[model samples]
Target: MCSISFLVLILFSTNFFLFSLLMLIKDFCMFIEWEVVSFNSCSIVMTFLFDWMSLLFMSFVLLISSLVIYYSKEYMGGDVNINRFIMLVLMFVLSMMLLIISPNLISILLGWDGLGLVSYCLVIYFQNVKSYNAGMLTALSNRIGDVAFLLAIAWMLNYGSWNYIFYLETMKNSIEMEIIGGLIMLAAMTKSAQIPFSSWLPAAMAAPTPVSALVHSSTLVTAGIYLLIRFNILLCDSWMGQVLLLLSGLTMFMAGLGANFEYDLKKIIALSTLSQLGLMMSILSMGFYKLAFFHLLSHALFKALLFMCAGAIIHNMNNSQDIRLMGGLGIYMPLTSGCFNVANLALCGMPFLAGFYSKDLILEIVSLSYINMFSFFLYFFSTGLTVCYSFRLVYYSMTGELNCGSLNMLSDEGWIMLRGMSGLLIMSIIGGSMLSWLIFPTPYMICLPIYLKLLTLFVCISGGLLGYLISNVSLFYFNKSLNNYLVSYFSGSMWFMPYISTYGVINPPLVLGSVVYKSFDQGWSEFMGGQNLYNKLVEYSQLVYFLHNNNLKIYLLLFVLWITFLFSFFFLF
Candidate 1:
């Protein structure tokens, strides 16, 4: 299965890569659609928009999934249900592909539902309580988006068709279309784990490492960005677009802060993924769909490699996910460490790396735009937090003493694992420039002041410095005072979203359900519907059992009278 998938992706990537490079592909004048149902001016059709965006996104999904499968061969070799795992991954890939090609709302729902369900299945693949809890969280969080999508479909019903591709232009002036766009942004927010829905993505790290790489790279979270990009024109000129821009910027800032406080290895990267998702979303919300798309592609390449390297390290470290428990392993596992560093630097938007080109463009564009002071500062502050966490992470995992244990047991000769990381490592190094040239040959002509132009550099440097200083300093001496205590703690705790989600959102419903069960299910329902009928039936059965008259004389008289009545009836007839 893995080999066949690999071969298929090779062909797909080659074909689409050339097509994307051909410089001739244009938007379709009329997309090919096949009707599934038609009645009274209403029709549901399977419509595919095979433009550069869909093709490019599909290629990345396939690319990431294939690599994940190849890497999982070694990562999951000893597992008892390896086949099941592979099949689930394949299902996820298919769902993402379906989502990519869909131009109709109904078909998009079909794919959207598939992704949510399959992701739930994958998240719960492990037979542990943590996996089950995480799976429920992941599933329920995404279910919100699923419901929003359905509502958007219902709203689209006013037009008598679900093909949103043809209606993008018409939606601008229509209030109903604006509402639909708002609902879509909500759905996208949930799918992308922005703000209120942010807790699930980190909890989802309970799944196997391969799942993490694929999800963070392309398939699951990107679904939201992909959907919005297709609908970008409608969102560009709406008030909801401003709302989305603000929310996405806050989400990016929040996640970056959260990553600095997180201790779990996979969770840190998961938080980083959240941060990058925020970046993509904020850029899209700002009306730069192409830049967001470019970042999405470049981010996928390096982020997947990052997860693969983390997986390798975890495998070598006996599944210890706490970075605090690891140190100086760079001396032994140089290959894995090297890949980790490359991916991390790319994530930090280092020059010449995959993150640099797209990130720089996004910053430049945001600077040129006339957004408010709050959003402008939030964008750059989030960028600084990114570098802060990266440096802190490096200090914890790669530098200092050998904290976990002696280095005598360390080894990093996993060739297949390294082989998987190598593919993305090369891309992480070059994907940005290749995509920059291909996607935006001419580039935007932005003329910013020196301070505005140097904003990102300033943030990154200041962030790096603070990261090193605080990471080296011991926190035990700092008294818990009102000055920095709340700020420090809040930043690390993901601004308390996890608490609000678990207690505020999840707990109230559970409590209500229990109360309902006790009051209605066990009390009123059982007494009225079940117990009452049961008591009446029991009484009737008891009376019948006793109806023979407890005496012999009574039975004889009744028999004689019955015989006499029978003879009379016969004669009368």
Candidate 2:
């Protein structure tokens, strides 16, 4: 089953990749519509758009998914439900593909909801408390996006069609269009984990590593970026663009900071994915849709490799994910370490690597664009923090003394896993340059001051040094985090974002529900409803029975009184 799945994915990926190239060369787009129903000059149609963008994205998603599934064979070897896991992953890929190819809002919603449901299942694959909580958070957070899509769909009815692509140019200043744009942005924000919606991404790491690689890299998170790219016209000249820019910038900074303070290896990587997502979103908001798409593709390559390497290490380390308990893994697992470091360098945008082609260009473009100092500062500082966390991760996991037991054994002996990493490893090395040349035939004209151009390099060096120094511990070193425990905890806990997303969102509603249960359901409602009505009916029935009871003495007394009253009335007249 695994072999057949892999072969089919590879076949489709190659075909799509070739077709995308052809479309790019010819500058052609094909829209296929099949009308499911028609009445009174109205038609319901399933529409597909075949263009360079959609085809290329589909190819990349399929390629990454195939490799991840291949890797999972070894990773999930001991699991009894391996077939179930594979099916879920395939379903996720299918949903993503549906989302990619469809130009209609109704179809997009179908794909959007599918992604959410399938992700929830994958997240809870282990059937544990953490997994369950993470799955719920993942599902609910995405439910927000799903609702946004639904609203956009309903609002698009004002335009008489669900095909938003056709109206992008004509509906520029319309209020309904603006509302739809805002709704799309809101949905994108949630799916991409920007700012307030950021908690769920890291929480979702409770899923298996292969799922992490697939979701964090290409399919789930990038779905929002792709949607925004498709609807870039709506956001280019709107207030929604500016709002997105601010929130995404903050998201970048927040994720980078959070990653630095994180100890869990997977969480740190998840945070890095969050940081990259912010980069894509912020750039997209700035109207550089192509650059955002470029970064999206490039990021998918290396991030997947990074996660797979982490998975290999964790698997051999008895399922331990804590970086503090790891060290000198490079000595035993040389191949995995080599691949891991390569991926890290790519993430840091090292020269000539996949990340360098997109990330470096993005930084240069941001420097050239007219933007606020706050945004400018965020772009550079986040870049630095990315390097900082990455270096810290490397120090804790690769460079120090072995922190585990003397009898511990670790090696890159999992050939299947290594094979999977190798495919992404090559892509991480060259995919950026390839994508850049293909996506942008005309180069961007970037003009910036020398100091500004050098800012990215400066931050990287400083961040790396800071990461190493902070992580370098001595035998008698004092723990400053304990002294400043509150600050440390807050910074380390993603600024309490998880608490805000979970408890803050849940507590008020729960309290209100309790109050309603007591004040209404149990209190006023009971009095005004069945019980009160029953008491009133009982009292009325008792009164009637008292007034008209069958008794001989009572009847005789009543008759005598009636006669006496009639005689007294006559005498008075």
The per-prediction CA RMSD against the true structure, in angstroms, equals 4.2, 3.7
Report lDDT per candidate.
Answer: 0.86, 0.92
TM-scores, one per candidate: 0.91, 0.92
True-structure lDDT of candidate 1? 0.86
Candidate 1, run of 10 with poorest lDDT: 21-30
Give the per-residue lDDT of model 1 (tens digit) for 1-573. Answer: 666776787678768666655533463333577888999998756787777777777777777777788899899988988888989998898888888888888889888999999898888888799999899889989999989999999999999788888798865789898889989988999999998899899989988999999998898999999999999997786787888888889999988888877789999999999989999998898888999999999999999999999999899888899988888878989988999999999999999999999888898898999889999988899999989989989988898777776644667788888888888899899999998887886877889999999988999889988777767774336534235877878887788887887788767889999999999999999899898899999999987877755978778888999999999999999
* Candidate 1: residue pairs that collide: none
Deviation of model 1 at 218, angstroms: 0.5
What's the CA RMSD of model 1 in angstroms? 4.2
Residue-level lDDT of model 2, residues 1-573, one tens digit each, is 677788899999999999999999999999999889999998778999999999999999999999999999999999998998999999999999999999999899888889999999999999999999999999999989888888898898888789899999998888998999999999998999998899999999999999999999999999999999999988786798899999999999999988887889999999999999999999999999999999999999999999999999999999999998899999989999999999999999898999999999999999888888999999999999999888888988998677877888798899999999999999999999899999999977777889988988988899888887777742126755567788888888888999999999889998999999999999999999988999999999997887698878778998999999999999899
> Which residue runs does candidate 2 get wrong by more than 4 Å?
37-43, 473-476, 530-573
Candidate 1 ranges with C-alpha deviation above 4 Å: 23-30, 35-44, 475-486, 537-573
